[model samples]
Target chain A: MNTADIKNEKSVRYHGVGISNGCVSGPLRFFRQRRKMGRIRACGDQREERARFEQALLRTREQLDTLQRRAIREIGKKEAEIFEIHAMMLEDEDFLEAVQGALDDGACAETAVERAAEKHAQALRSLGDPYLSARAEDLHDVATQLLRQLSGERPDGDLSTEREPYILVADDLSPSETVTMEKSMILGFVTFGGTPNSHTSILARAMGIPALVGVGAVSEDCDGAYALLDAAEGTLTVSPDAEERCAFEEKQREVNDLAREHDRYLRSLINKPAITRSGRKILIYANVGEGREIAQALLNGADGVGLLRSEFLYLSMDRYPTEDELFASYHDVVQSMQGKRIVIRTLDIGADKQIPYFALPQEENPALGFRGVRICLAREEIFKTQLRAILRASAYGNVSVMVPMIVSEDEVRACRVILNECMEELEREGKKFDHGIEFGIMIETPAAAIMSDEIAREVDFFSVGTNDLTQYTLAADRQNPLVERICEENREPILRLIEMAAEAIHRHDGWIGICGELAADLHLTQRFIDLGIDELSVSVPYLLGVREKVTECK
Target chain B: MKEFTYTIEDPNGMHARPAGKLATYAKQFDADIRVHAGEKESDGKRLLALMSLGATCGTELHFIISGSDEEAACEQLERFCRESWGRGE
Candidate 1:
């Protein structure tokens, strides 16, 4: 097996779909599935065969129970549920009956279990539902366990003898196989056949291990070879030369440093304020789409919910969501924030984000057409319902109302009138709400940026929606691939508009924040700090990185 | 015999989670239960059997119960259908 001297060998590169993101270098070890040592001959005694089958079932059950407990401890309960389901499948009458019938025909317990599993697996495959059919693999996992028990074979092959962590190479891995192995001993995974949606891929992602799947066949001789597995680039290099090895080590060090610095080091500073060197306290918040993401936002250490797009509830429903339904969602999100400032933007749907039930007439350029506050003001009842819900939720926590797409003071005053009516209605109904909840507007349109001075006085704060501002200011449609370069290159004009809004809002003693894609751009963190932006709100994943960038900035 | 029909509203349909839940729940009943999905039918007490029915979203499940505990089983199964698969939203 020691055919090639790894040091003198030329490097071999293999490509596949990168299911997880990371880079690792190690000696490659092929994980071979432990098959039952040959065919099982029928035992003459039927009762003895029955006893053997029963004992194997009992042992398999115990092993599954242990795996379930270990999985729950190491991984999450959600991932561990597969083991619970497998345990249930063990006692499934169809499976047990098939196995018993095969045993009655004088087949050994191993053959009986194998045949029964194949029969049920074939039946499941013929069902034609892809998700259900995938359970065949799970069924096979259970059968393999049973066979192992009957044959008294070890759960895994002898890879535990290796001293250092090795890259696990296999044809594909079952969920049981992935979970049962010691994750600490494995650096990464390279599979010959699997998908991004495979159980192994999902487990690898959940465990934060780099993996490449569906890479086609790798030679058995490559085993024990020094390798570089960079799942970020979806490539595995075997027996890399000195130069290649140097490059691989450099990349691996950078990835390791980043994972350690950003995830561990930055996460330690999550509760700390994202204060700049010049002593500007820039609040870091998360832009979440729905109530379900509130937990994630909180976990990522968002100081507040900066931009809660209210369109999710409306878009999910066939008709408009009722005020109570909207209130239920908003109430949960607000309560979860636990008195942290949560800015809930009213429904900003239009031609691009049309709810079929809205039934607005199609326009030539929907972006320039009636949208945001225009649609809300046109439909006062919808706007009022949302306002009432937000107001109702204000009683629980620090909630704020932020209007979207305001081009003029007229639109601001119009929304104010409707908001006041909703407050009055709430007052009459005796609903307890924060009477002095903060009000703000999204500075998206160029006209809104130009008229920020007049608009800032009416609202408590301003949050610049830079995605829309960039497209509108540059006269470039963001979705157009042809003008994508134009949109990407032109940031100075958008930054200037944001600077104007920041100055105007600060003049009124109201703070300004950027709740846009640009907010997370670390390149502009120093630029944004210079412009006197009070807050930055990005998606949950970028929260920590942006926080790190803010501290890195002058 | 007690019988009722329910359309699977869960987008993923009778996958492992729901099927296992159904099998586990049906095991508690003394009544003989059978679930039918389109042309295929399965013993409600078995997880693999229920899964073999391959019921996807929009597939109607006709549940038939027969035994001494049929009435209680019928009522409970109906409630489960309304609570779990009932959200036609």
Candidate 2:
């Protein structure tokens, strides 16, 4: 059928959640699941059922051995070991015991294998290890192979049989299946079912491959058809018309060019300072979530880390992370930064970033009530532990402590008292730390902005957290659709507050920085420089873009 | 039987690389090896089992080996723990 007829037949477009950024147009290679074989109930005899299972195991082992070798040559040694891991899991004594136990209980070999695999899969998943949980997929793969062999079903076709690099369209894929593929031949992934948090989603994101998940079924007639898999928008257009194909190709090229441009152009800017046309040198720093993001920030040419949101450590764990655990993570980040400034925001939780262990009381307005510095000031032990950890990390790098959501000079003074006490404790323990490490406050409230002149005198620096400042100043919820215009039209008020904070911090010979989404806004780059803001910190991805914008600005 | 304990030093804990290498190493000897981390006990020869222990940084792992080559297994695996495991910290 022609493109016109194909477009009219059934639904040509499928929608799903995009896993990563990118797009691809290629032949749709459907990863067909093996059709169910007729189940022949075993005679409830031990010998016969055992024989069937043993034979199935033998077949599976041979098949895996061949696949392992082929995969080694195709993908490389490291990825090929996935097959080897599967083989070891297949023959593990504990797993075999479960499988054979079910067979002994008169269940057929197929059901027995499925039940055993599910149990072990569940066990692995409960471990809370992302990689180990990913191994649960290996269990399912091995079990399916064994089941297929027991009923004398043919194995799935080799992807190499296809000539072109194909977009893998499937009902679903286990992490094992996703990793084991010849990643080069796989253009992208489109699955009929998978949530954003599914194992396949994790794999796709890790692999940096474009993927669309939860796209409903495609008709068999459309198999092997030329399709556009635009994961940037999470749409699959099958048998696209000439115009659609041309448009998709253009968009794909734009994405590729921009990605490559960011790498090549950004690498050149890494060692150079971000200087505006008028010789105003702006320090472009990064706002990172955790320690791992620090490495990427450094790679992207961050002058330093302006906002290390320390709440992530609290969020990722069940209970409060021990001071030692927190110290280890912070130390690694500090050591890697190599004397660069790392302004760590101390536990900006109790707002949207809630922890169940903290048991924060439910409020009508969580953002305004019992949050940030207020919570930290009330929960002395938690605040002290974090302060101690930040102090310890200061020994490794030029680490600064920043208090979030401070509305008064009193709160700043109180934090300084705790800060000095932490220093005293560290000193008493004979800990080698930077005693002169700068302490700062985040100007995130209208009250904080109003009182910036007084607050700046209490701290060594000021970082205007514009996201919260904007919302607070305009009295409009950022997430509320009805107040979009209110937030949109209120940029001038927030900038004026930043100007006040910058001026206040400057009066005391202290540096002021902006570490929020507004820092990445190209239009605001010039105003920030003109306002004498010392540093502008956005996320890692915007490090170069903001730097480029700064150089372009007068 | 011969047994020894080693603490996890890697911030990533007993992830794929260390677990896979530990499994491959444990399989070479004629010994039955078991590793206990917290409440989880894993067959040392099984990669997934070793990883399933969910041993984070500073987790103490006790390796128990029995059979013909228990002594050799302990010596080599202990060295592996010191050298290969918990690197890049």
Candidate 3:
């Protein structure tokens, strides 16, 4: 259908599966522009095919640049830069030569691009680095998207024209495409494929959309069926009975009203401490992973950054971030916080999170294997680089360095030794810093929690990583759905660990921060308050909710 | 021309709200306001450029202003640095 034809339609239904959260309602728009793909005859000579392949590559490069510029204009500069990386992929001589080789075998330009993308994707997957492997998926998606754009076929599907707010169903939406959707028009999202860790899901959650992912065939059944979606419950009903529709509508309204009321209350309490009626005070902090998150955390009323995941800086790069790169990143966070507290967790890469560039050995039981503080112990160079970066950043603002996955006092001491060494190195260089820059340990392992008293003596504070703690305490693999029920955040054992850790740290005159998904739990906010957690570090979006909960508890 | 050296005491450096606020302040005066860290210089009235400078806390920066109201621009920026950008104030 032509753009005008689709735009003029009053209402239409194009169905797929929902993958992420949130609802948007707006005019149905379709991005149907395709990239032009040059065809090569099957009997073409190697030289002829090679020339055609090069021409196609040049055209693809131009198309990518144009898309990238449009992306920059539509989104922000940072997001647009993601496309630049893809453009770099197109320019890789080795990759281009491989595609040319395929085209010389009598493959069309489209087939050659697809074949090359698949080969590179498999190679990346075999590398076994999640982030690097994920990049392979990104490369594959981008190449396919670019090829399709060149082939005169739209990779993105048509948007419906129905005025009524409806959920978008898709196989999976890329982060870039998800951002392009008008927020006003999307009612919600349902996808057949996508994990919570996917960037699209993260963005949807950030956008506050109710999303249900992995609902196998719901999208096909819901086609043109005026559906009702309960995102909180991860339920989608296609053509529900009248009563169910009425009930869902009422529930949606109630949720909207409550959200509005909560927003107003949070605005009123922005400048106020999260104190209960009984004068109990709780500090609300942000769990930041990157520099961008620091600004978001501050805007959401975070008094400081509770957990700055340092892995992002090391990932997606060719080598260890130079001290200058590290300094610049940390400086960005410190400057953005405007002097608010920033607790940075040193590189926590291990089994589950790997940096292919580092080439760490793959372990059978990665969870209990070489990771966290253990990895740092063996790879002192990587650890020291991070320490130096954090230390140099400390010279900038209220920055504290924390070691993750600590299991014993010795690990704490060893980390402290390296940190001090780095600090001493800086001191010898005549660099000034908060000599008393606070050092902390992530109490993820049960052994660390049990030995909190001893660890506390060596550090300034403790931050309980509830996500890992729950998994370890329950002896349940978090990724295993069979034991999902046992991994409940509000379970008795998890709460007790938090209570115990907080008490132990408090006895030593040390503070404790919780930087887990549990920190954002509305139901557990009061419990955290009661446990006397010095800081509740949550995702930025949950800051207001946490602030209100803290205030109401007071 | 007026130049002053200051440390970025505000956490998160000169980004987001602070950068926007500083940009607004810069536009109020008829000065050629520029912020420099090492070799990087940014338009003091543009938040994007200022943020790209990545000036974080404890990083020494030079605020250079020239033309009319140069003194006012320097004074305002200096005050922001010294007072911790009014965060939690």
Question: Can you write out model 3's per-residue Cα lDDT over A177-217, one digit (the tens) per residue?
Answer: 66546554566776655555444565555566666665553
TM-score of each: 0.53, 0.52, 0.56
Question: Candidate 3 on B1-89: residue-level lDDT in tens?
Answer: 99998877765555344654566567678899878988888777764456556666677888889987888778877776665363542
List each candidate's DockQ score. Answer: 0.30, 0.11, 0.01
Provide the overall lDDT of each model, using Cα atoms, as 2-decimal numbers.
Answer: 0.85, 0.81, 0.70
lDDT of 3 at A99: 82
Alpha-carbon runs more than 4 Å astray in model 3: A1-176, A179-261, B1-89
Whole-model lDDT for model 2 versus the true structure?
0.81
lDDT digits (tens) for residues A97-152 of candidate 1: 99999988888777889889999999888978767767887898899888888778
Q: Lowest-lDDT window of 10 residues in candidate 1 chain A?
A: A1-10
| lDDT (Cα, tens digit) per residue for candidate 2, span A1-554 | 11222466543877788888888888988887753443757455778778888999998888787676444333334455567767778888778988888887888877788878888889888977665666676688788888888877665644756767888888777644564565657888888866675556766775567899877676677778888988888788988877788888899899867755765786798889999888989899998876766877888889999998887677679998999999988898899897899999998877455688999888888878899999999989999998998898898879899999898999999999999999999999998789899999999998887888888778899998887998888888864423545776779999888888888889888999998778888888888888889899987657888988888889
Comparing 2 and 3 on lDDT, the stronger one = 2
- True interface contacts reproduced, per candidate: 0.85, 0.29, 0.00
Better of 1 and 3 by DockQ: 1
Docking class of 3: incorrect
Residue A44 of model 3: what lDDT?
59
